[model samples]
Target: MRGTIHVLNGPNLNLLGEREPAIYGHDTLADVEAMCRAEADAAGYALEFRQTNAEHEMVDWIQAARKDAAGIVINPAAFSYAAYPVLDALKLCDCPIVEVHISNIHRREAEWRSKSIMTQVVTGIVSGLGVHGYALAVRHIAEVRGRTK
Candidate 1:
């Protein structure tokens, strides 16, 4: 099987290094992309790393991944709460999907923060590990892909 991993980010993740450094850490989205690239490359998998603030774009990417990607690692950001479209699109994907969060949403102040609509469709989740979570998510998909091969 072809090994192509799609790493998708949503919403304010573009402001990573500058947006709430205390909670999300100081790594920029570029930094996270680089980490995911390295991990994917090390495992001999091609990577498609992307981020968007728009929910429609995220849904489009997830839809594309259903046919073109071997696995996916997504950080749905604010959309994790109630973006049923994204979740519905994710349901179409047969490949493994891993959800990542730069911070532990479970420990956040708001109860809504702990709930992720994506949780039902993803293969697994990586949370609270800072930027390294992206790398770990990629690594997991790589491992799963390897096993299938």
Candidate 2:
């Protein structure tokens, strides 16, 4: 069986740690990707780590994951709240999706942030743990995939 999880990021995430150190922590996106690769390997799964600022690219990747991966852990970043195209593509695939946010959206400003649009579609959501949230989500993806097999 094909066993792999896709860790997809969207919009401005490439700047992760430096984006806002106080909010996102000091680990760059590359750092998080490396951590995820190790976590997936330890859990006995392969991973597809990708990031794109373009909405269409993200949608295309989500569509592609239908055939390429067993699960998806996506941190849509600035796209989470309003990118309908990306959300639609994600919903079309069977891969379990776990939405992640480094900073808790609920505790943030009144207008700058909002709840995830994919909340109902996601198997789980991990927020407020900074980069650690992605590690948790990846582990969950592996465990969930393991059982379904």
Candidate 3:
């Protein structure tokens, strides 16, 4: 059976496009969702795309995905630095996890911003790739599952 891929976004990502055009590019979250949906459809996987500003909510979704999803693509946003609970929840996922960052966190001015706790638990990461990162993550999950099948 084909499985669902959960795409989770955190914190200020809902304000994409208008928040910082220079760093995040001009694509809105809706645009990113459309792109991801199209990619998931092409791969014959159901997409469960979600964004939240609350840390607890993000963690809850991650826990939910553990039961229902075949894989996960998450952009933890500011939570990448200190969301230990989020990282812990992600550890429960048995399927592949791909972490995404729209901007190159390594190139950011703040040293703390360059770190991602999620990297420890994820299968791979897509950074500095703009909105296209979501599609890449979805495609990767699809490809990996395809090979397994």
Candidate 4:
């Protein structure tokens, strides 16, 4: 079966546009979804977009993607630092995984914020490119799955 690409967002990301305009930017989560949907459509693939403030819910979605999705584009947000369960679920994906960050975590103030446990399993990472990163990630997933023209 042709599968869908899951675009998942983590904790506090629900606050996108209003959270931290200087870092996260002025585009809301809805804006990001529109961008991802457009890219997924342009690439001829179905999209499954979701955001969660709870870690278990995020883990549940990742596990669900194992069977339902072709690939994943995730912005783990605050969970990036030490979500071992999330990392474990990601390890079972058996498909391309792209980790995206709206702001450059490396340039952020906190040292711990710069590290991501999921990085070891992700196929690619897009950072500091703002909301455009999500679209790039969808394109990359499409390319990896040979779904792009």
Which lDDT tens digits does candidate 1 get at residues 35-149? 9989888899889999999999999999988976889999999999999999999999989999999889999999999999999999999999999999999998898888988
Between candidates 2 and 4, the one scoring higher on TM-score is 4
The best candidate by lDDT is: 3
Off by over 4 Å in 1: none
Output the better candidate (2/3) by lDDT.
3
Candidate 3 residue 31 C-alpha distance from true site, Å? 0.4
Report the number of backbone clashes for model 1. 0
**Per-residue lDDT of model 3, residues 48-136, tens digit only:** 99999999999999998897687999999989989999999999998999999999999988999888999999999999989999999
Global Cα lDDT for candidate 3: 0.93
Candidate 4 lDDT by residue in tens digits, 1-149: 25699999999989999998998899999999999999898877899999998999999999988865778999999889888999999999988899999999899998888898889999999999999999999988888887532
Query: Where is model 3 more than 4 Å wrong at Cα?
Result: none
The residue-level lDDT of candidate 3 at 21 comes to: 94
Query: What lDDT score is found at residue 124 in candidate 1?
Result: 98
Give Cα-based local distance difference scores for all models: 0.92, 0.86, 0.93, 0.91
Worst 10 residues of 4 by lDDT: 140-149
Each model's TM-score? 0.97, 0.94, 0.97, 0.95
Model 2 RMSD to the real structure? 1.4
Residue pairs in steric clash, candidate 1? none
